[model samples]
Target: MATHSSEINGPDVNDPAINGPAINGPAIEVDRLTVRRGGRTVLDGIGFSCPPGSITGLLGPSGSGKTTLIRALVGVQIITDGTVTMLGMPAGSAALRSRVGYVTQSPSVYSDLSVAENVRYFAAVFGLGTAEADRAIDDVGLSTAARQVTGSLSGGQRSRVSLACALVARPEVLILDEPTVGQDPLLREDLWDRFHTEAAGGTTVIVSSHVMDEANRCDRLLLLREGTIIADGTPADILSRAGTDSMDEAFLSLIRHSMAGGRSTDEVTS
Candidate 1:
């Protein structure tokens, strides 16, 4: 949303700004990813790829491994087997230090610092300056609270601070986990708008949400259920394949099919 010519770069081959074209490939790729925690399977073998300029929504109910899957993509979660690659490099590689931006469910800003200060800190990590931080704050509609102490802000405001921090870096891949949990509908819409802007700029965006309605905003959807991916496709594809107009119904239908021990013909991919 905050377009900085030099800083907000993408992996597009047609982009005239960058010297060499980015390698033509999916922004993210996973193959048979599996994770086990405390001897319990948290994520079954899963594989998928997220192309640049696309918004991939991770949809599922609580304990559906959405958060766990996100953690794996961001390189924070340990996997039992399989591989996750981001921007052509392995997930969590030091080479990906500034190329990937991740915002967790919990706000990761400093409560003792002001909103502007918090964003400036993260911007500095990416070798950015004050102007970039302010633009990111404005992108999230938090310019008015720039000088306010982060601890004094409301839950929703604090969440925006976290989002701003992530946006400040203008990463090639933006991963958000339940970013709109504390935000209002209007703020949610604004945030999703910003997400679209990022995706349109060739940033691979991965947004995790429990709300099925948000799936419509994504170009592709990954519906996870009980440590497995039940569906993978566009909103319409998922609905059409499930033979239902309602996303909830589609999810239920897919889940039932999975429980019946049959792989979704065009649903889950692994």
Candidate 2:
């Protein structure tokens, strides 16, 4: 899927129809959000905005604060300082959680349940009815294996089931953390295509991934290091700034450049 440069910028991110002072503010807005674990600052003063209807990729090396930032957005980890708003509401609020679907790296499926049964179970948990649940299952292309036991399915198939469950409630924002881990390249490509299709149809997707190859598919890339944003722009923009041809090289170049000056990334502190 191809993305236009303009979409990667700040404008036209959220749905103007749902326009409220906050919900229409930005698809995601983080300001000085600091998180600490065991007295160590995992994320410090990180901030960014993801406009509505855009596919924003969170890219960084492991231990660069990607997971911490993700947790902050969903109101999972306690914020030591600052604020996070999703669709204009404060993060972790009931309203916000109700409208945002989250899929984590770990397979959260019921291993013993049939694929269809697993979907049904999640749907019920999220308060979806039979028709809605069935539609969600079909949307993720899990209809064929609907009756297959989840424990017996391949890893890729299990991921599909998890995705279906996430989308079952039709939330306005979908947050995926390393969604394609453990999948082959072909499957990852297919998943990217599916994400593009969904995003174009009006879902705001915030995906955290270390896969540089998939970075180009995102509307915008948020490069993080040690919980700070090193760079935020389209893949081409970052490449241009780093004077590199590939996202992989650009990331390394930028990281070295930022560290040389004693900075983490864009979110780095003095």
Candidate 3:
């Protein structure tokens, strides 16, 4: 766990967050959600809710069910049991088709289309204009590549184009799967800032990433392992729960504690 600590980000104790969101209901709610893949359980009756106007980080090691959990949230994965509701409707409700934005691991853009064309098409699909399309491209740091074809771009650039397409919609709920997997430090920092800005504007943003350092940037976190939740709470809450001030040390302690047969639900609640 300590060696893997290099992959995650830390928290800021002095960072202040706003209060009193206009909408008080949970943006997403999962009740006893379960998923099984390849004759093995991927998510074992896991449940949690993400509040509106907040950034919730879904983090864990490889194969810890992070991708599958996020897939369920976007209504693209089949579940054996449980219910997922977004904005007071079922997970895959028709009403949410335009209200929820999902960015998968693979870039979902037309390879032949230029960045601006790709984003503008999505924007138009959502009844938006060129301003919104341009804003989304800038938000993802792809302004210079606006006229470049996506297929000729590098993998990272293509990923940014996909993100731009999603951002152009400005959906009420945004679900991202490792949005910054191979991005450089400067771009990663810029993208995280964009996420914070989106959350501040009342969008429920859920991001899945392998970077531990980014965990600190989230308002709350859901730590998972082997299809079960190990810990769930704010960064400060998680540190206090693990009896440590360092994020890396705290995760090591919590993982050890969970492996020692004491993964109680009480430890997951705020």
Question: Of the pair 1 and 2, which is ahead by TM-score?
Answer: 1
Query: Per-residue alpha-carbon lDDT of model 3 for 56-131, expressed as tens digits?
Result: 9988888999999988998888989999999888888888988899998888899999999999999999899999
Candidate 1 structure quality by residue, lDDT tens digits, 55-124: 9999888998999999999899989999999989999999888989999999999999999999999999
> What TM-score does model 2 achieve against the real structure?
0.88
Q: Per-residue CA lDDT of candidate 2, range 1-270, in tens?
A: 224664574334344543333344578899998998999898888888877678999998999888788888888878899999887788999877668888877778998999888888888888877788789878777788888899998887788789888888887789898989878888788788778767765677899999898899998888888878888888788888889798889899888888888564343221
Instruction: Report clashes for each candidate as comma-separated counts.
Output: 0, 9, 7
- Cα deviation at 137, candidate 1, in Å, is 0.4
lDDT of each: 0.88, 0.81, 0.86
TM-score per model over all chains: 0.90, 0.88, 0.88
Instruction: Point out where model 3 deviates above 4 Å.
Output: 1-24
Query: Per-residue lDDT for 239 in model 3?
Result: 86
Candidate 3's C-alpha lDDT? 0.86
